[model samples]
Target: MSEDFKKRITVAQADYTKSFIQNVFLQRTIFFLVFLILWQILSSLGIYPKFLLPSPIEVLETMFFGFIESDYLFAILESFRRVLLGYILAVFVGIFCGLAIARYKILDNTIGASLTALQSIPSVAWVPLALLWFGISEAAVLFIVVLEAFIPSALGVRTGVHTIPKEIIRAAQALGARSIDLYIRVIFPSIIPQLISSLRLSWAFAWRALIAGELFVNGVGIGQKLELGRSLADMSQVMSMIIIIAILGYVTDDLFFRTIEKKVQKIWGFNK
Candidate 1:
């Protein structure tokens, strides 16, 4: 390619990346606007009873007033605490277990397959066992969240390790790198992308698991609020809880995970 043409191409690519980020922000705003309009219209049209399918206004009121009266803040905080505790535990265990399986064929063959199979089982499926083992306590909820979050994290790490270039490992070994040094300096650093991906996936898993546990245990959370709304036939509260959850999930994923992914992709020269 001509130097002038290459220079133009580089400038175009930079412009495109900036435009893409702007577009994503615009799209998110547009999406929320569209949803709000549709919700308002549908509720006004009385597709369902107002109480059964509350309007956005009613839902917002429930979120601001009804939830406060119900001590929703404490519930949300408790749920967040449980989810974070379980997620952190899952990350630590998954990393250690993944490294072990990646380093040893025997461990991989004996345990990796079982772990893979277990992933197919929905986290909610373990609720009964968790309740039986730990009773309807925070431990049961943590157990369920851990079960959900651990599998994807472990798989992500294992796959990341497996995808590491053999040449890099060999070169590190030649440089007198022991197992710890090899992983720390070569293998682990090489999989930052996958680790971030795992963190995102783990958050989703744990969130779902937390809701499941709340449903079963009927504890303090948005999930418990959902159950309470259902019992009282209060659709506005239900909708409000759902909206808050969607907002929270989107904000976390976009602000943290997607942001990281973009930077990493750019650094890896894969963001074009």
Candidate 2:
């Protein structure tokens, strides 16, 4: 193919990709708007009770005025604070456990397998134990969040280390790199991408766990509001909380994980 033809093909491909992305965003916006319109129309028809199917407008209105009068903002902040604490704890514990399993054969044979098995258990399964051990308090919620976040993190680090070429380690050792220096100069950097990927997974797990954990907490929280809404058969309040949870999850994912992922991709030459 001619050089000019090749250049034209590349430019055309890029333009098409950009246009496709724009169209996708537009399509999603249209879909959401149409869905809301249909929901409003059906709910306003009065065939079904409002409690069973609230109009989108009612849900939005409740979310606005209801939250201002209630402690909705406080609930959101409390959940966020708990998640942050659990995330930090998970990162530290996961790193240590992962390194121990990866570096030592005996620990890998026992604890590593156990952790892998534990990962299969749902985060909610731990709730009973957490509540029994700590009661319906912050500790139970924190424990559940840590349990959810740490497993993926440990596994991710182990995979990253194991997947590294043996020759790279040998070459680094030959250069007199040993112990902490070897990790700092060679191994640690190589595992950063995997570590960051796990952190994203950890955040997702933590977020889900937080909501579930909050259900057990007796105090103020979004999860508590969810339960209250259910008891009162307040569908608008329930939907509003669900929407808030989704928005918060999306915002955090974008703010922390996606930002890190983009930067890492750029540095790793995966992006132009």
Candidate 3:
């Protein structure tokens, strides 16, 4: 390679490193620790009742001791299971519905018109109907979680598919690619980046829906634990549960999608 070309590559690498540092959440770690330190100081000074706003130390202790002494670990695992199951089902159904709407012009416009209105309804609004239809069981919880995630994903896929450049479609069609084959060879690949982005949004929706479901449904999970803390007026447990939920959400997204997202960006010659 030429010397100038090598210099360009080094510049690009430096730019990418700078972007990564700005975009990643690692920088917020110390900021949160500082916040915790301030919280502990206030708690020590008795600015508020411990039961109402427990200290950070108390919250950590509650998480450690509660899990060791009780079924908290199982509760967390069950919660993760429920969220994953609901999210998977949502993705499947969403992809089907999205593709159908995108395929048929009449349905495309019709559903597109109503999609926003339908999705705008909060996930929690379905909880009552879910209970009525499925009773006080896991189904009720699952329904709300699925409903929450499905809307965004379906919309995402349809939008992604629709947004493909017309020239690309025409060229693929000219090459004898038609219908399913066209989609497999051209459309699907083009939409993958968008699909990944949408799935991340879907996870956010599913997380919110899961908490709402667990609060009403008879289940052993974070929502149930939150309720238990409320009944006993245990602020430490409540705080700990909140932190655990936040941690899990962050961890799961990083574990499952971060690698793929970065790879896609790299492939697209975006920030990497």
Candidate 4:
């Protein structure tokens, strides 16, 4: 609409482009390829025994071959299902707990400190208790995952709610907004950005916790396969499974969570 406004928009676009160029896909690909090359070189020279440290190519071959032998697809699907179930439960519960803590200062001051302290405890630490309660089952894995996923999300939502401008809340109240309407119409919308930011963190925690629990449970999951690989001294299978887990984590985070976050931020006019 104006010359200065047009210049500002152009500058913002250029800055975003520059920042995007400095990070993201190409850099990740380069690093992955370099690591693979180094791995191959070291393996070929026998710096480490092939049984102990299979090359990237060997790992890839084993993964591909496994697919040919049978539908490894089910393993992928099952792993995904467990992670999703635990993560979704955490999201719902976290929102409620976060609202309670953030809306009440006394609760926030007391439980908030405890939640922060709990976060410092690694998710794996809960496995013993979880196993004692649920006994080497999906329930145990889910319990660990929920513990990992819920805490950061709850903290994020609380922080986001607290950070909303006090003037905005007062103005909405002055406009005769009721408490429920105030939260739904004003406060919730304001905190969506921070909530979205925490989803990425929550998913990562869920992933790691899922793997840890699965490893302990020794059931029909990829983590169990990893344990089997270790027991059989099948380094290739172990490496292949690790690669699969990494790829799955990256794809889900990048394609789903990150894409949703970008869209949410853009719609909220917070970022581009």
Identify the leading candidate in terms of lDDT. Answer: 2
Please identify model 4 stretches exceeding 4 Å from their true place.
1-27
Please say which candidate is ahead in lDDT: 1 or 3. 3
TM for candidate 3 is 0.87
Best by TM-score: 2
How far does residue 108 in candidate 1 sit from its true spot (Å)? 1.5
Please give, for residues 1-272, the per-residue lDDT of candidate 3 as tens digits.
Answer: 99999999999999988987886476687679899999999999997888998889989999999899988899999998999999999999888878888888898789866877888988889989999999989999999999889888888899989998899999999999998999899988888887888888889899999998998877799999998898899989888889999888888788777778878867856663
Tell me the whole-model lDDT of each prediction, alpha carbons only: 0.86, 0.89, 0.88, 0.88
Model 3 steric clash total: 0
- Spell out the clash pairs found in candidate 3: none
Candidate 4 lDDT tens digits, 171-249: 9999988789988999988999899888788999999999888888865777877887899999998887888898899
Clashing pairs in 1: none
Write one digit per residue (lDDT tens) for candidate 2, span 149-187.
Answer: 998899888888998789989999999999999988998
lDDT of 1 at 259: 96
Q: Any idea what lDDT model 1 has?
A: 0.86
- Tell how far residue 9 is off in model 1, in angstroms: 24
Q: How would the candidate models be sorted by TM-score, starting from the highest?
A: 2, 4, 3, 1
Return whichever of 1 and 2 wins on TM-score: 2
Model 4 per-residue lDDT at 168: 83
